[model samples]
Target: MTDYNAPLRDMRFVLHDVFQGPALWARLPALAERVDADTADAILEEAAKITGQLIAPLSRNGDEQGVRFEAGQISTPDGFRESWHTYREGGWVGLGGNPDYDGMGMPKMLGVLFEEMMYAADSSFSLYSALSAGSCLAIDAHASEALKAAYLPKLYSGQWAGTMCLTEPHAGTDLGLIRTRAEPQADGSYQISGSKIFITGGEQDLTENIVHLVLAKLPDAPAGAKGISLFLVPKFLPEADGSLGARNGAHCGSIEHKMGIKASATCVMNFDAATGFLVGEPNKGLAAMFTMMNYERLSIGIQGIGCAEASYQNAARYANERLQSRAASGAQAQQRIADPIIAHGDVRRMLLTMRSLTEGGRAFATYVGQQLDLARYAEDAGEREHAQRLVALLTPVAKAFFTDNGLESCVLGQQVFGGHGYIREWGQEQLVRDVRIAQIYEGTNGIQALDLLGRKVVADGGQGLAAFAAEIRAFAVDAPVHREALLEALVRLENTTRWLLAGVASDANLISATAVEYLHLFGLTAYAYMWARMAAVAQAKLAEDAEFCGAKLACAAFFFERILPRGLALEASVRAGSSSLYGMEAGQF
Candidate 1:
């Protein structure tokens, strides 16, 4: 079984120590009254219990059983419906949704923590709920007040689930090419006709109704993305009493059987003149859809972190308990027959790398979450702008780096198990498979890099980079200890930022080609800064309690000494530019 205890401890450290999140939460009037340290801790404790006891046990089963499609219906793995029932009954679906619409109104910072736990427990099961929550966020942000009052409550209560329908047969990342049409009807509604592929939770047996926020073009609309519009298409029409009424024209033509996250029910949806309501303004669908897409990007990153946490726990347990070759130091004569693999330096190295990345990733996520919260709730205009810039700059990094590291960490965790890692029984391989999608979906890591380098870095005149560099500078200057190491990382980041700005204008391809490496370098440097800050906090806490704080400080040192050095390689790779990546011929593959 995967151990969630350590992960939860790390979460608390990130929340209380690294972020002092509760203190910030106290500043926002709406969130202040509802969430305090005690309440937040209680929520986290309950979340951990639900995740470990309920969700983790079902992970492998969900992956194995997958989703089944018969006729026009979709059925998830056995026990998933029951688990989802418990999940919704607990009001988890609305954990961070809008309070005005009957959601729990938890802060995104808190939601990030629970999301990490959810993903760690079972990413397959977590994805369905994530889609609903993400869709709710988008709707809450952009949908009309009537729509919010009508649909948000049901989505929050789990009476219904929500999905963002953007991908079509022809359009994945390029929404300008979408063929879906939404024509205005006499009743002031629209009739939607189109096919959407890879529509997760498009149609499922889990909820009473499915609410799809779709993107389509109006018949008279101009060509390309500017002509697009967003529409709300429900699986079933609503009755006067707000209950599900007649079935709509939308149906799941089929469900996809894929490499991982099988229980998610990726669907190919067919909307045949589906009755729909326009969301936001006409010809602004892409902007509206991005409200949800951005959140999903972060959620997917959490998925990666969750898988890495799971893999690390499983691998660590195996290493400690599974006796193998003798210690290299010849220190344990009593167990001379065989020593645990953990006694080997390489195994320890892998485990530490996993720990550093996982813990650091969570901290960075919370940091981003704090910025998101501030962007909405902060009283000062400058504060909000600062927060927004941070969100914009770090969002891509959080989405790409965390997910990529999640896969890397999980794969490394699997390798620590040797051949047993590849086998099905151990569940290590499942984690590797589950985390792979994070890198591919929610905008490929490559695209995320391009956005970071092109839009976030250069287009904004390096404002985002400047803000992030400022944050790093503040941390290095103010942090009680480990200041030098943090400063070192910041210095490296500053130099890289200058290089990116200088190169982007002269040779745009240079930025595009080297974007991924620069993003990684930036991510690793940022993570290193976070780890150093966390280590400083952990070190101070050690004076109060030795054992608890000691382990944390050790993990911090492990991150700086062993993991932070990877930034050097990332920096080197970025300096290499796109020459190697783009120069190859099409037939080279």
Candidate 2:
């Protein structure tokens, strides 16, 4: 297995050269004083060094050791606790955290790359830190000042960690069906009683305390998701002096033995009348939970990219080293009995597909990150609102598309390795196992599609999609290359979106049955738009760095010529409607 390396060059190309991230950051007053191009570059270099050097080495052993649950206490694999201490002390847990609490105050554009590298290096380790960052986001946005002061510093510093407790044995996607109860007490806290399953980083040896952001119902609350409230429940309650005090009622019942990310503990937590504090307003916890959903969802999406990149690196390295039959075009290396597999057309195709999709996904992720920055830090309200709309429109795509393509990319990388890919020690199989969850978790790829097509697009009469299409068109107008191909895909997206929005009201199950195809169609178009923008930038800078810009242009061509055409099939599937999907009765063979 090849060691994982952060794609710092492409990351820099996307951040500075293509998207003008520094320019965007400079305009946002919140980021202006905090970050610059050099600072951002330095962060990237340090992150690359840390992830590649520190975390990447632990992946194989961590997977083998997994997490140990002994007498209700869950311990991480060897080296994890020490790594976590180092990571936390470095302030990485609060890389994009609120500056008010000593966070580095970096923007999402930078965070996305860091996350990609972390996940790529070691997904299991990344989850512990990812959940902490996500929990901090929710608390910073919705929690009270006191709660923030008490928890934010420790969490940001990595002294403490956080987890989101929403799923139960019976409730997965349907939060409305959750039975967890939150009863108010005279002391201005609540008593939380619930059992949450599939809680990532719920109970680990990495941190001093674990802050669980749990969802439950108030005593007087109405039924369903609307009545659900978010509570801040701690494993170890802190005293007034900010030191660890009494143990809370929350306990780790056990952890799951999973197919992938074995090193990360997936716990079944029991909150036996645990003392809890409300995060946001009463009966509005669902709303509050979603405030951080965007961030979490995006981070999860990057997991796919990271794993794909890791797999691709190994596959690419193997393809060059593994000797095989001479290329169909004849011997390229006269010294060897057979040429490297890389000389084969099919192998080249697979490698290029992985590269194109991974690179395009990176660009799209950065674009979404840029919008996140705009949504939070833009001086103009209109810009902020528009950025939010774009975020709502694209977050699902970022999650589902990146992951779906991530799996595809990983599979392709595996295929390039032939039989060796299946071997456990090679790490290709591990990448496949680890990335598989990204499609299943963070609200599943299917749920993300429904949210994208049903809520973000159809519910708004496709205004969000329309605005996105317009932006693509606007970019294509000045694009240096592949303008026509981008427009063609955009038109297809617009038409498919029209069909979906128009039919969703009449056919209630339209979104459910066809949303995946709709999302793919949208994803293809989105990547095409990304390629067009990137191609334009690469074209202009061809003179400065011919080799780098040339590679960018080649990848863009591969995306447009070799990959983007998949949109046609997806559009057709969406237009086919849900009739065939629902035609069979439940009992039918």
Candidate 3:
């Protein structure tokens, strides 16, 4: 097993250079008072320590112990409960929540960094925090003032945990098919009846209660996705005095036995005429669920980035320590048996690839996080609207591409270890298995691609793309020499977006069949742009420390020379279209 190390310098580079943290915080009233550079840096350092020191050591043990279910009760792995207590006591779960609700009210950008670090250390442990933050976001957005006042405090305090219950046995992404029903009673509460599957943190012993934000249909509601409504169903029904009362009607039937993330509880939940209160207007549930879903999408992207970073660190460390064949030029001066594996060009290739992707993903996530903050807190309406559209446009890409990179990066990391990577004790194999879910869950990467191409770009008549392109072009115009790669990457993205838009009206299938490849191309181009921007900024800061700047420049060069060409392959695949994919008849086989 490898010890986790927080990439502090890299995080600082991205926070200060890539995103301009101070200026952004100065613009938002909610975060303006406490989010200067020093405070942000301190927060990141503290979060990194907690994740690396407290959470990382428990990862392997958590996996080994898994979550235990006995006699209708659930218990997390050893050390997890202790870590959860530490996390809550440190005010982490509420890092981005409303201040009035016992939250620290940090900006989403900062919270995301903390989140990625946690995921990097132990994703299974991170789930409890991630789900709570997500639930708070949704409730803050859609729930009544009373509900937010009542639930957000406890959730933020980590006295209680939260779960989003949208997936049922018959539906996951297609919520239109969900059969969960909510019937109104005389006292303003509703009776919720249905089963929710794949609910992370649905039922757990880590908290006093589990608050469920469920989606169900009202009897008088319209049909399909339009008819669904959001509800707040807490495990322990609250007293009028705001204290815990009797237990609610919902319970966890069982926890999933999965291929990975065994320590993170995924439950099958049964809401047996559960007492529930509507969070939003009737039949407006899908819109509200999206509040949580979109947040999770970005978090899922971070999951990918985190696991990739973890895998890369392990692989790089192992390569440096393990002696193998001599360098290509043959042993210059014999030290021991041959030389370290890091001496090989191919090994360097894998390490550089991982570094480039992981760093790029982190930068991208921060960029999106900044947009989210601006959308909520910027003074200008136009800026806020633009930020909102950009957030929507980029969320799916971040979620899909980053996770795709995550899976590939982990696989490559495993590949570097050869047979040892596949073995259990080495831990590399576990990462390969665990990171796989980020691609599948939180809306499949395929679904995310379809959303980006179909809804965000084509359906909007290129408005969102135009807004993003205009900003990138503005940045490219002012950027320095090495930023030329960023300019090229943006140009490629613009051309690809234009091509997809042009073909969409004639063939809507352009995105349906080609969306996944388009997503990959888009991700590579965006990441390239991000890497170039980071390198250029780091270079300017080099007088402060040349070694750190040199590393940034090296990673940027590696991305351009080795990784950016992947855009071409993905673009070619996207242009290949559905002719071959859907052409074969059912009888062909």
Best by TM-score: 2
The C-alpha local distance difference test score for the whole of candidate 1 amounts to 0.87
Question: Each prediction's TM-score against the native?
Answer: 0.97, 0.99, 0.98
Give the better candidate number (1 or 2) by TM-score.
Answer: 2
As a whole number from 0 to 100, the lDDT of residue 113 in candidate 1 is 89
| Candidate-wise lDDT, in order | 0.87, 0.92, 0.88
Question: Relative to the unseen true structure, what is the C-alpha lDDT of residue 214 in candidate 2, on a scale of 0 to 100?
Answer: 98
Model 3, position 206: C-alpha lDDT score: 91
Question: Lowest summed lDDT over 10 consecutive residues: which window, candidate 2?
Answer: 496-505
Q: What does candidate 1 score on TM?
A: 0.97
Regions of model 2 farther than 4 Å from truth: none
| lDDT, model 1, position 305 | 88
TM-score for predicted model 2 compared with the true structure: 0.99
Ranking by lDDT: 2, 3, 1
- Candidate closest to the true structure, highest lDDT: 2
Ranking by TM-score: 2, 3, 1
Steric clash pairs (candidate 2) = none
